[model samples]
Target: MSTDQFTFTVSKTDGTARTGEIRMPRGVIRTPAFMPVGTAGTVKAMYPDQVKALGADVVLGNTYHLMLRPGAERVAQLGGLHQFMNWPYPILTDSGGFQVMSLAALRKIDETGVTFQSHIDGSTHVMTPERSIEIQGLLGSDIQMQLDECVKLPCSDDVAEKAMRLSLRWAERCKVAFGDQPGKAMFGIVQGGAVEALRIESAIQLAALDLKGYAIGGLAVGEPQDVMLRMIETVEPHLPKTKPRYLMGVGTPDDIVEAVRRGVDMFDCVMPTRAGRHGQVFTRHGRLNMRNARHAEDTRPLDAESKCAASNAYSRAYLHHLVRSNEILGMMLLTWNNLAYYQELMAGLRKAISEGRLADHIAEVKEGWAKGERDGVVEPIDDKAIAAED
Candidate 1:
């Protein structure tokens, strides 16, 4: 039966790590899930159908971009983001807080909310907590985030505490604006920049709201990998276990795996797609620069053992040539391959946690990356050996 009220159920656990499903009227989202960034309703270089088939339960939309170009009301009139984009599944939309903060010199922050000049043009706009919720509602976002202040890392203790307090205040306003949406969810973002006390306080206070979910933000801005992981560790305990925990804008495959181990249930990032467009390929054998000279004469497929057609059908030499020539098809193929690999990794993590061997699975996955490539050739993984190890 389809659930009318948003709900999450944890089915398995390995240490602090967990595997679960978030059930809503539209669909079920598997965790530890990775949401691809579909900034302006479209995932760059890929079709919606392809995105669904690649194992993504949800794709993220940016409120700032959409509101600027197409406008939120326009999307609603056209039948919301799902009907407009041809994606029938759940969609999560950011509150535009991160993008607003990124505007730096172009924006001014105060108690009323952020006032910023649009990058698309010189027009000025104000995005209070209420306005952000209204935009998400207009776009029919299944999962919505509260507007929060996201400060860059290496900030002072005073700065982090101030941002955290403001975000907590905003969370309250966003909650009131998001009242009684049974079929949807409002997630409060925990922002403390890199401070342990501030992160804990943010998580505890947000969890007190008893919202549908929580997200750990403010870490991936410029901090070290260790610092990011530590923040996750610090915040995880304070968040409620029943609700989902999201690590916002998290990074590399290694970062995802480690964060999952630390108990994050959801994630979103532009790493795979962004890296793909730049001729970078992520694989079970680690990252490969397709534009490298070594691939120019190689004839092997990027990953002959994989199921994605782009990964299995194209030769390294052809891909290299396409990248070198700046072919559009090259970007398309590489983006497809990268998204496929990320989904594959998510599937592996789910399976590992279910079978109670996440620790070993993580070690093997890291070992695969450690074993990079031999003379520019990445040997195929043996499924039988992996199963036996499990």
Candidate 2:
């Protein structure tokens, strides 16, 4: 596992949807992978072991939260993020630029860096490209993102252009500060709001740096789903085909499918875990809300067809009870179920792409979601039946 030898290999391609593998020192992440967010060094209510058991190839760590809470220096002192979190798998750390701009107050942006108060305790901190790189390095991230300004959606062209240009300049600084390493890779993020021309400029400029990977940032903030998908299409063709394309902080199940169709290979979002805590569970037959009174006395699992034991073994009635009673296990079980659904979706996608049946598979998924579950029914599909179908 030579660090310098990190690579992505496309095994199959159907249209723009591809089934590939990203080889890293810790493990090989399957392309079109949905990385569960592990902000603050935990995937909220989940042990790292359980996360891995859900077939997660990699997990994302937040530089902003980690730096604010445990401090990057403290993590490094304890033997890097992998050891600090007790997860011996690949970890990708964001630059903290997005969080600082979006989550912090009184943010002052300058050519040098961004100054803002920590959302946690209102302490002041400045993050430069160099500092962002340094923090990620200390965290020992396998994939480190470049620090880039994330502009709010619906900004004027002039404002968007300035931020895009500044982000490109910062990308250069990030590259210089990132230096070089064997197994570790630094990625450059393209920021241009919603303008195609600025997006092209950002993509072309970042492409010139030739980072290990490229990520499209700043669109998912408040833009419409179609707008985000269109922006991705605008930038995808200009990016190097050999390097992986990542869409930052993106999306729902439908959003993921659309982005992959446009050639994105990686994604990270807090939707699954966050929504899980709030009683939303992703299933083959659309989203299920455990808080609904309809689920009371239901003996069926969240998804009888799910490969995950948690999804198939636990009754909806029990889960609903746990959630209504504010039991911690409710959050845990539902989070696991949601992640399992995501992984299952990814697997279906990969299989579809490989077999040149992505369109049909996607149609089936949409149809299943539309059909949903029968009300007041606990018709759990047996594991044997699901296995036979597969």
Candidate 3:
């Protein structure tokens, strides 16, 4: 466990599924890892210690947001993102390419880079691959992504090919800009929309650069789950087996399970935290709407078996009241619960993969979700309490 250099070791594999460790100087990331999105230096409503306690080995920092606000230079001056955010574990950073592309109307892309108006202040900025790498460096990212154009799916093959080629070019620039970093990595992103040939070609080309790792981008961005899986299948075959594979911006629990089955090693998404803020919570029994009236009189905890306090200690009735009343604590509790569940799922995946029973584990997990919440007797609301409130 001496991790002075960046390394990825697959400890076990079940068919295409894998269990592994990505050893960085800062810490070790368990493969099939789900990095909670900590965009703008925070994972929304949870504390850094809580995020770590929930079993996340790494958290994702948003290059676009961090570079725009607080500024990369400022973060570096403030002793990098780990010190700035107080999360000392591994921090992976996106290249800011997706956020730039998301600003479709406000941005223009060229061979050089993306020139766009900032969403925060409408100020103009340009992001080249080299600058993206530079920004990630300033943030002290352990795992940094290459700047690549991620086109929305269902586009023409011609458009897909164009973007894929452009991304390949950008990948080269990012690699060169990243230079030599002992315990850090700059991952190349595979982008080809839904075109199989383009995806294969992109993967093959990026694998040639032989970056520290690879990420499958341009997926889960409005594409059907089947299509996304198809893209993963196509790209996974062409990429180097020894390197880690990350599927970016993916997804629900089902999506993670499917992608892991197809050989993805790392993942990041905003679904869990975002869903929590909206009064939704994901559990072993699937997603539940805490805002629903059905939970108004339920005394049952979200999951009594869960090690998460929010899930085991709080009653559905109380959670329902908090969410309905729009209390901030409800958002924090639900967010914590969701992240805990996701990490638990990841731990399960690693164990199942090691045991050579990933398929069985996935089936059981899906079954629990399909079975939904168990039926429970509702506790009667006290009439005197209700009368007093009225």
Candidate 4:
């Protein structure tokens, strides 16, 4: 892919935080962007229009899920993932590599590819690097990820080295299969488990391939937060500065902030949306559990100042009632609110980076979340009440 074909313009860089834009044929994705996961072609309870209304620039599709469910050929027959899903915005599709290793049963790894039984219905499937790229191309993805081997964290150094080497081989195959397209781009994944030397080796090998973008995969897979951050720090400097860097399947609000501080430009995770379905709501003041009894009598909105009606117009008591009663509307509303919150946070980070105040902005966010509040109003607990109980 030519540099002019898909452009990532860095408007400003404050420390490791950056504000930029990735212009593709489908649409423009703002940098430091958070892509809502639309695994299996939908964003769970929310519709595509509703997701766009929540201010998402782009959404992600899982290759393994789509390939197994409706099949890639079917999606192409139905007019690609964008039209099939009714989302006209840009979509990035993952290579089925992760699912082949993680979701499948009776897995066997070899140089040719991975062979495994489908978790759904116990069927069989084989996924190669070329096949993964072919599927993403069939889906007409704006951005496609390379098929790479992902080793579990806390593995032996020898195992980590072997996986990293295999991933490099797969990256080459994916790039060759992807060929050349004007707007479409393929991103290589950097996989080296927790070993810093292996991470550097993987980055150097993938950078030599000259792909459009690079993703730091194989982290946040149950590793401690500090170890993941250290791995990122080790690989960040090796990646090409002109191209975008993505961190796959990464984390909470604090994790996102920390990733930005370490020079990561893109992220995808199911945390907010998936967590919301189970009664967890993310706010400026940390995560709040709507299933808790404290919210049963609380009549305040989740966030009074939010522009999202789902968050600002509903009372905690009503939300709790819905969740407690197992109403489907509860999941819908919470998913919308959580997605809106994620987008709002990303917008703030972009603005802060462009203005050269990201460090201060991050500190302020940490402090605000540390001092948790309800409905944006802090309630002081009486110290005398505790003394009286004693």
The sequence of per-residue lDDT tens digits that candidate 4 reaches over residues 174-221 is 999999988878999998889899999999999999999999999877
Q: For model 2, state the Cα shift of residue 28 in Å.
A: 0.6
Q: For candidate 2, lDDT tens digit of each residue in 1-390?
A: 424467888899889778898897888888889999998888988889988988898999988888888999999999999999998989999999888987887789999999999887899999999999999988989999999999899999999999999999999999999887767789999988899999999999999998999999997777889899889989988999898989998778989988888889999888888877877788887777788888899899988888898799999999999999999999899999988899888888888888998889899988787677543232332323322220
TM-score on alpha carbons, each prediction: 0.95, 0.94, 0.95, 0.94
Give candidate 4 misplaced runs (Cα > 4 Å): 1-4, 373-390
Clashes of 3: 0
Question: Candidate 2, TM-score vs. the true structure?
Answer: 0.94
Return the clash pairs for model 3, or none.
none
Number of the candidate with higher lDDT, 3 or 4: 3
- Model 3 C-alpha lDDT per residue in residues 149-185, reported as the tens digit of each score: 9888789999999999999999999999999999999
Candidate that beats the other on lDDT, 1 or 2, i.e. the better one: 1
Tens-place lDDT digits, model 1, residues 257-372 = 99999999999988888777778888988888887888889889988888999999999999999999999999999999999999999999999999999999999998887777
Candidate 4, after superposition: displacement of residue 1 in Å?
Answer: 20
C-alpha root-mean-square deviation, each candidate? 5.8, 5.9, 5.9, 6.2
Clashes of 1: 0
